[model samples]
Target: MNNKPYQRSELIYKDKIKKIKDSNIIIFGLGGVGSVAAESISRNFIKNLTIVDYDIYEVSNLNRQLYSNYDNIGKKKVDVLKENIKKHCKDTNIVARGEKVTDSNIEGFFNINYDYVIDAVDDVKAKLAIIKYCRDNNIPVVSCMGTGNRINPQMLTIDDIFKTFNCPLAKKMRKELKRLGILSLDTVFSKEKPVETVDKKLGSTSFVPGSAGLLLASYVINKIAFEE
Candidate 1:
């Protein structure tokens, strides 16, 4: 009778549980991808987590977003996520920041000094700001790219941003990062050619986005928990 909340993770990871629990990670964006990543991280007994998002849940989000539901509609993502994680994962210290990360306020936004940063944002400028800030500070970070419009979860791969294919978002980020002389980025990207949408709005799937989110969390956790 394993009575511990995170006994499963503690069991498999063995002596690495404390390192996993001590990881101070911050994730930006709480849509389908980031929300799922937070859940995975929290379940792994990550004790310190910070989730940032300025958006509220909308009716449209229920289709793919992990945290979106009728009860949470119109509620801020960070607040909902914070409430949920704290209630279920009592050992975690969750910080919910309802501010949009932008170029102007980025310095203040990153005041907490996370050991690992996850970029799950959709905005180009916001993503750029986050990567650059982390790069400058020498903090390890991973960015999620183009999970939208992708259907095949198996096609998703984690690699350097420079090598990612079939992801328009990765292509755009490549050009911008090059201009900034940022040579490399740890990225989670889909190799699936996106199914074009007639309305031009990014289409999403519940599985792939959440899968990518798990990949992001796994990458971060592996570094923190398994590294020598």
Candidate 2:
């Protein structure tokens, strides 16, 4: 190997590595999808990353969450994710906030001008808040729709939100965006219908949310690295 770290990536990114490294990105959740997305982006050597999440891991989250484990149970997700990223990523600068995004705090939470934004939160209101703020400000953003109650990773795809179907979360977001007069949005969503289970609670696997997370990071990285 010609270098110790990022050698393979450096071969592919070449001169664009600096641009990718310099891009400022913020993710609004640290659940399964957001956790995987944050780690994936950090592994790519992206320098500036900010993650916002208020939830703490419980026994239920062990199913699909990237940072959830027996020892991390009851700990704040943002703190766990920040520590995880910092452990492996020396070049990346991470900001972790434990505050829950709300109508009252959305403005304050999004005060900074971000190059790109990733929406991975589970709350519909918070997701819409982030999308609205980014849209009104003309900031580039991509959102992760529903990954819950699904198992097939292959069904995950990225496209305009209006073009998506079969995913309930996408439908809700689409309707809300239309009502807001926001015509278009970019998002990672699943084409497969959510599997009906015996219990009413939503279910998930390691694959679906994780795959969407990978696609989310890929969307940002490709735009900054490959686009001419």
Candidate 3:
């Protein structure tokens, strides 16, 4: 086990670095947001990770996905991210599941005793299910909302779902979560109004999604390193 890889983090965290290494983290979705979040967590000395994603890298994903590039455009996102994480954090134990997390299979995915679960999946049904499952089970979860259709990285902030606004996705999530009796959740959301696009397709940039992922990573890492 080469602790040298996280030497700088070890300085501030001291022996608490071991706590991070022992953490069991699961991230759903390996697109622009989840890919960066997974990479950031792995580099921070998280040893165990279960990454779930069924998508393949397309040329279009190169704009924001950390594991997407021209060379791996046709490859599976979970496999690509697992290989990349292993290359950097040799001691980390990463399990890549190339499958989508839906209501039908959600129970199987959360069977393991994960210390942290990141809900980066965009589907409203899946996202709400994961969040409700975590809340009901008393698990720590951080959800990312609407990194697309925006340009400002500064507008991204971490807060409960009900406290977020200006992003359409967050607004919808707030209503859904409230109906489910879930009053609070840690979420990364942008306060910027989405840009008007003629085609009505979500417009995204390289930085917006990347920044949201980083913020989610930082939030999780800090909680593990300090709060734990």
lDDT of each: 0.89, 0.87, 0.88
Candidate 2 TM-score over all chains jointly = 0.95
The estimated TM-scores of all candidates read 0.96, 0.95, 0.95
- In the predicted model 3, the residue pairs found to clash are none
lDDT of 3 by residue, 1-228 (tens): 664888888888898888888899999888889998998898886768899989899989988999687999899999988888888888878898998767678788876788889989999998988888888889999999998899999999998888888878888898898899888889999999999887898888999898999999888888987884
What is the lDDT for 175 in model 2? 87
Regions of model 2 farther than 4 Å from truth? 1-4
Query: Model 1, residue 74: what's the lDDT?
Result: 97
lDDT of 2 by residue, 71-102 (tens): 99999999999988888887777889898887
| Model 1: residue 153 alpha-carbon error in angstroms | 0.5
lDDT of 3 at 80: 87
Q: What total of clashing residue pairs does each candidate reach?
A: 0, 0, 0
Candidate 3 global lDDT: 0.88
